[model samples]
Target chain A: MTDAPKAAPATNSRAGTKKELSEHFKTYKHVWVFIECEYGVIHPVSLELLGEARKLADKRGVSLAGVILGSDANLIAAAATVCFEHGADLVYTVTDPTLAHYRNEAFTKGMTDVVNTYKPEILLLGATTLGRDLAGSVATTLLTGLTADSTALAIDDEGSLAATRPTFGGSLLCTIMTLNYRPQMATVRPRVFGMPPREPGRRGEIIAHPLNLAEDDIVTKVLQFVADRDSNQSQLAYADIVVAGGLGLRSAENFELVKALASVLGAEYGGSRPLVQKGWITADRQIGQTGKTIRPKLYIAAGISGAIQHRVGVEGADTIVAINTDPNAQIFEFAHLGIVADAIKLLPALTEAFRKRLSVNRLAS
Target chain B: MHIVVCLKQVPDSAQIRVHPVTNTIMRQGVPTIINPYDLFALEEAMRLRDLIGGEVTVLTMGPPMAEDSLRKALTFGADRAVLLTDRFFAGSDTLATSFALASALTKIGQEFGVPSIVFTGKQTIDGDTAQVGPGIAKRLGLNQLTYVARIVELDRDANKIIVERRAEGGVQVLETRLPVLITMLEGVNEIRRGSLESAYRAASAKIVTWNAAAAGITDLTKCGLKGSPTIVKKVFAPTPRAEKAHQVPTDGLAPEALADAVIAEIFSRQPSVESDLVRFSAGQ
Candidate 1:
């Protein structure tokens, strides 16, 4: 259905100058990370952000803080302490019963209120479902720029938060700057940052912010929290080693072969986007940009000709072993090890070999 | 039950590549498709309109050529198509883009009946930000449901909607009022092709075109690059790994032998991984 075409818009029109950078925004200071928790347990991405923000905070010579929103005061106080242990210099929080389950309306209003009262130069959030839902609404409410799914966050030359993310469908990377906005906001994907070592007995300042939202104000309600049927809980996010397959496995039956290898090697099993689309695996088992990002010590990919979307997810792997029939597969370009063979055959053989080797080692020991 | 679906035309990411030396996106040969994600949304919207007595209007903000995507939507049973394109809308980021689209939606309501629901793809592949749908919902004061796996129920008479929304590890069955913005996750349903008769009607359909002023936008500064707060300072391909994939020779080995050789090679290269694997996989 391609028809008449128009010239593509020229990509250059950045509003020139420090003149547009208003004086009122100068009052904004420090970097803030939204410490998201569900059912009392702090999401690991929140801890990951503390480390990333710590670096940016040090670069700009500013204090780093975590904003914890929860339903109970005591539970939130404990979460705030963990933030201190994970590199945050201070904690800003609000504890209200309504804050328990993530409702976009209440959380957005609460976060927006805090940002307006105590502006920060940079505000970070995990790119989780809760964080994304809140960040978009909050950023819109604050009338600021928000860079989403950022792979990297840094302090620019002008002391602005420079958020780097894969753009154009991960074909390339672009650094975004919210030049004139207060609370330059960004949502970093999980596993993009390492968990900074906790300093036991670390102390930090705690500031409790008041949340104005009440139950009656929110339009949406959490009818119930439905835990997934398959409660393996998508450990791919934190798995030390992952074995992933793609459509190259040929069928869901063949997918079990990938899982067999992972089992023998004592690693987690995952697949590319297509396998998830084919219903061979649940969405949580999908690994790529749109799925869980992983930084395992070892990643074995079979039959997956890496798309940029999947490439971004696995690039952090300490070692990547690619198996595909196509020698020119994009996975081969970056994989530490490559094999030109059918994953259907190679996976099963690999599983048997690993089983024998591991068993022999166990017997000898 | 008037529904509006937001559509975007993006380059086929599968065909897109990067320049090795220059590290620039080579979009020269890639064909533009109606962002594949949006098709899922279009199908859902059309299905609702078919089930209920209503109209399905498709809208998008891109170059003049984006009208082709709208026309294609019509072929899939959309009743009307609106294209919002203007030079004043160029260089807009997600924030500015949402502002323009929301303004256009308001005008569409004033012109053609108020829409009860606004549907959009979870995210555009080109942007991959997944921010615009929520931004628009916020601007227009619509209840936003994102990454929806299924529409469990839509009660036009009761002015309510229930959907299965994908959360971190679970699906949230959320209920909301009408006039909500729903961003459909991919693969909820297969897109249907048009019948020949429908294709004929789509070819002859009159597409509505709106410029910034025509779209009822009040401020000029908030229309384009001036409105956008985020600026891209650098766009480059990621640096390649220094050590490329080391190929394992598979010339003269049986399947078992090949596997054994590969395992031995892996151990020799990463002796620590062998110990690490042993410790974890040994039921520890």
Candidate 2:
């Protein structure tokens, strides 16, 4: 089917839209976050978003609402409770069987329908795979603006959502404002904002809505879901200690040096984004803006130049040690400790040394 | 079946240096290459073309210089290249970009055949938004399959397409129909090197150039910054941390001794790490 021709502006200029658009959107109030729920589990990024959304909602003197779409009633209710405990003032839920799986069709329709009904001034979603999939379509359906992978979000002085994100491969930061769009949308990566403390027994108003979507209408069918097995575990995000390699590792074989250190220290091993693109590591083990955002207690980098993209993902570490031959490597700027040496040679020695220290400590104990 | 793959010319980020004084990106001397992610999409499109009896058309929306990227795609055996360039498209955000590109695709469909599938990278390194693909899909009323790791099955006669999409903690094997927009995941496939014949063909191939109006974009206000709802209010570099890392002198020491000194320093700074390391070893 061909797209129907879109209606053009009557005034025929950019200046003609803002005043009319803002007035048109005057009724759009409150900040709403789409609580990402699939199967029976609610994504942690949804809770984190509610925390950030609460701040934006409070800044605008409006209610914080969390929109959850799921097939199960108990799961939706449970997620709504968690949302309320975190920060949401109310919850909007659309329960339907088609919503059980994250199909772009069902979720987008469910989210957009609720959004159109409630008229939220600002909407937020986690920048997870599912969130990105739904946000792109929803924003397009609503003909609004969406800033993806925002590192920081705030309410501008004029009461607009100012979303700041890394651009130009994370070398630069830009603040984007949807000046004329109601329900200004943006997606934030996991752990970009701190999770708020949950208040036990906190209750909120729950508003229920019908999905009005049938299984037949959805084009994409989920044939199966192969959950990541233990053998393929790459829990880099939650690891207490993380050891990562970079392009400086030279070859995939050299990357084993990084894995050796991590194995010795009982740490999770990962590499930079390029290593993933270069097939040295899986996408899950990539440490950068586009990959996993890690918050480790101790992070050790070998031969990583630590670009801004990689820096944002690891800045939350309690302690970071950077090992590279170049003293001027960007990783040194934020790292707690710096060692100027070739990771290839130093990694094996470091692994041996760490193993000996651990064994010695074990003997003493 | 006609397939259109979107390519972008992005600065080689490794060579991108920020001006120390102004903290602005130094564009000079930095080479431009086809977005690395787009290569996967182009390769996937070409593979489909090779499997089925069809042609792969590479499309891009950028400055006139973007023709270089289009030429590069042609070297990969694309049947045609279309460069959608216009002064009005400058400073366009994702929304505006999708508008222009979707319009161009429409024109392409009218001129060529309707594309069975439209392919794009999961995200551009420069924009990194990954929104434009879905935006185009929505505008064109096409089903979108994003973050697709593999095209498991394709039956053109049945108009069925099944793909493995990488989702949270799992792989969702999804089945959809034709007339879809797909954003191919990186590292799934390697881009093939161009043959000598393909290289010669690319060097002489004429890139189809279209202005906004020529691409049937009548909305002047919707072509560029004017059409973009999101405005970039500020551009700045991330602030460097106040405290630089404490240097561990590796002057004359071997790797082993240096490792020992590093361990001591870490333990001295954070006494808790020593206890934690012991616990880790004990658990192992």
Candidate 3:
């Protein structure tokens, strides 16, 4: 196999001979969202997309549909019901025994089958592990386009999907339009969109689809799934408050002081991208454009310079408190409260004060 | 077995300075550097090739200047380097970029031995999309694994690779067959320096530059903006918040007193937050 001389590109995998759009592609209507469900619980990002899809649906004057794929019929039904509660007008679901765990081949086949049968003009998915894997495969199978990690989505005057998101490492925002592609696909991060209110009694039509896949046909297997629910695993997305450290902290050992403040405040602790790259913290604890996006009520930063990459994740906080020695650090520009002091010195003082005050309040109550 | 690593050349984003007055990028003397994340991928590919008997070829889709990055990969112990470039491929989004790269890889596979494994960075620092790796895998129909923390086992005889894939909340142990694509996570392993002999070879090696047509791109429309569906309508900066930071009066104050002052300031602003904190801490 190694002896062949390298030459021209080999042709395979949905390489279209023609360049123009199909008239059928123009007929594609409605907003469809892929409902990402794992272990009987639907991923929250899917519900968030339904909320966003609802707005796009309203703008386009079309129905909103949620597409769910799984092995268990009952689980798929439950997901469809939840999708309805989250403002889906209808649901197209595919159920099969081979679809239990997220295998790319099965999910792509199921999604492509549903999409080809009932076309959608706009499609959204969560930028989760499963969603990214499935979206890329489905988009390739369909020979369409997909924009990843969009921060904003809207229907423009020409009836195209306008997806806006931070680009070039979050230094600037760019609005992208998938004008020529049918089923304009994009993935949104978890916290970028709102969680739609669930109408408890709301119901929608559930159209069942079939996935004729067998176990032997799948190439990959999920050997085992171990929950990484360790105490240190980050919970920044749902935290009430977050304490983050950045390159300004200087040393890996100094990052612990950030943790001390988080503990005293009962908040989640995280670090910027450089801290993670320096092996000071796990990637899971990294907060930035490339990492987790947080919307905590209060985000306390100690020694962070607040680069635009890090700013994108923490800007959603209600009150940003930045503590840095540099008076003119970028963080102070956006921080609701700024403290010009050494984080090493100020963290201990803040930790002690918070621990004492909170304990006192606890005892009094 | 053969391995192909995809890399990119990005501006050294760390050194870019904003002018104090105009807030415009200070591009003077800002050097082009290979994206840091791709180094991890290159290193992982080299390590795998070293462990088993195979060759590692580096690939990139960029302008002619990007040939420098491909040569750098050769200096880092790649067996060969290929640069896929064309004027028609300019301003291509992830979709067009992946299409061009995938065509080049198919060409690479036909020229060399079919690659058993393909590797890429988790995402480029500039694009930050992380879509190309999966896109290539899907187009090639390889078992795609993104955000791989570690390569646990590679049984060549069995033609299987097991990896620890990083997900949203946990690490998933996946066992997949050969001809798989992996997007290496950062900081997992440090990149190694090129040997003296390899560095010398890299200095003299002629990089194979291919245009879109030579790469067997059949559709010209899909080669650039025509193939790309995502059109950039506008670029803008986020508006700064109306209100600025309200610094607590801590000038000349002791540490303990400063903490107290900040606490008082916060409590005065939000009474509900204090009560919620107390209730949460007490687990009520």
Candidate 4:
């Protein structure tokens, strides 16, 4: 509206809800990871968190504990065993029929109740949809701090949980700290950390808790759970080698060059977010902050102007090879190898070369 | 029925640039637009209001200049626009920001009929935290449904809402009551362009501006930095790796020759990739 604004009362007053930092938070101890278990399967990110939590717990001279909420006792026990093998020194279980599915009300209440009863200095969760849903509600209910999509976590000299994440649209990085909040909370995306080596038959202490919530009290009801039939095709996140193209390919038809290269190398193929939006690639194949976070052994990016969003997703790759005609493309800063050439031309050449090399080896074999 | 859609005016991240030497965000010529994601939320709310008899009030908490975004929302057929602005809100993190917005929403409910549903984009591009929607829901004690892809059913008489939520590997059909908070996933619906008559209406629409006090926020500490639990201790450019990409000279080199050279470089750097490939090829 270009019309004059109807301003509030002239008094420049500052008044809102006040939540004081608790003084007894010093008593908070140990590092805890929320073991995200749904449909009797544990999310890999939960185990990855346990791996990193083990290091942070060790640094603080505290035990690494995992809090698992579920309806079935057998599932909970099995998940606890997996947590122990992954790195958890202790497991906190809350078994309630209401806690079976990831309804925000029950899970938030269960998670907050555990934190309030047994105060943990740090609480970690996966940045998956369910984890984010519960973490935000629980953190707000507890009046605590929570950093989302943290790329790194460490214990500072003063023992605060320092969570680092991309900020300002991923153009810059900032390190955030919950200086005075109990259960300094953070949510990390999957594949940001390495999976810890599993120890078979590892045992951990189990502390059972009750989720005092009743089914009637929970407002939201789950009608049905429909698993994606083609979920297996979206293996971009777990692929060992990824070859992706970008907008610079000129047209959707040219994207086939990327697939040809990937086919020859026996690798996965993906593209930048623009390609997905342009309908050149499916949503699952989009790689970036909003898309899948990938940590492949080898990543080849063609014609992609590595924006901040794309950088965060592929930064985890061990060795990145960039092919861009623009000499100053941002991907070169992070790529291990660079070729300043047109991807459309170079991709087919690379595919032919790889195919020939492999075929020659086939003949020898 | 009453609907409230939370909007944010953010620097077009596409135009935001970093200083080459100092690494400071250069906000000089960067234009501000309604956060791209919030458009889906706005469009969805408008659609619901058109389907059911209701008013859609677009709300935002930012500097006074954020009214531009509110006006933009009005042009897109929002019935009303409310701006929650104050200097105290500067440097507010997601938690603090949510507290302020939640307080404002409570006041809006008191003034205009209590909202049946609140809407926000899945996340803001500037902060990208995605905590505010759930934070507001928890503060207001509303059911929270995030990353909602579709609203399957909405029965005003029954006060029931069914939605398809995007989960880890599937779509979850969830049923909840009225007065819930939703963060709509992107690409759910495209925003519509206003008609000429709607443009004229928006041009004269008076934006209701509220300060912290007017929003019925009773505590000063929680309105701004003092309320935030997390502190940004450092902001810096990502440190460049120890070494940059070793450039393969492409001058006058044929595509095949360049490809061979690049392959040589890859094997030299990561020998395992070559070995892994060879083993896989032999197995095939």
Judging by DockQ against the true structure, name the best candidate.
1
* Model 3: reference contacts kept, as a fraction: 0.58
Point out the worst 10-residue segment of candidate 1 chain B by lDDT. B275-284
Candidate 1 residues A99-207, lDDT tens each? 8887787788778888888889899999988788888888888888888888878887778888877776666667778888888999988898888899999989998
**Interface root mean square deviation of every model, in Å?**
4.8, 6.9, 8.5, 7.4
Model 4 interface root-mean-square deviation: 7.4
Instruction: State candidate 1's DockQ.
Output: 0.50
Model 3 lDDT tens row, B1-284: 79999998877766765555543445678777788989999999999888987999999988798888888889889999999989888767677778888889999999987899999998777777777888899888789888888999999999999998876566778899999999998888988888999999999999988998888887888776566666566555667778778887678988889888877777777666688789877873
In model 1, the fraction of reference contacts reproduced equals: 0.62
Q: Over all chains combined, what TM-score does candidate 1 have?
A: 0.94
Name the runs in model 1 displaced over 4 angstroms: A1-11, A15-20, A247-256, A274-282, A325-329, A362-365, B279-281
Per-prediction DockQ comes to: 0.50, 0.49, 0.39, 0.48
TM-score of 4: 0.94
lDDT of 2 by residue, A200-305 (tens): 9989999999988778888889999999785334377778889999998899999999999999888899999889777899877888788888778789999899
lDDT of 2 at B17: 77
Q: Fraction of native Cα contacts kept in each candidate?
A: 0.62, 0.70, 0.58, 0.69
- Candidate 3 wrong stretches, greater than 4 Å: A1-22, A231-234, B17-28
Summarize candidate 4's per-residue lDDT along A208-240 as a digit string, tens digits. Answer: 999877799988999998999877344788888
TM-score of each: 0.94, 0.94, 0.93, 0.94
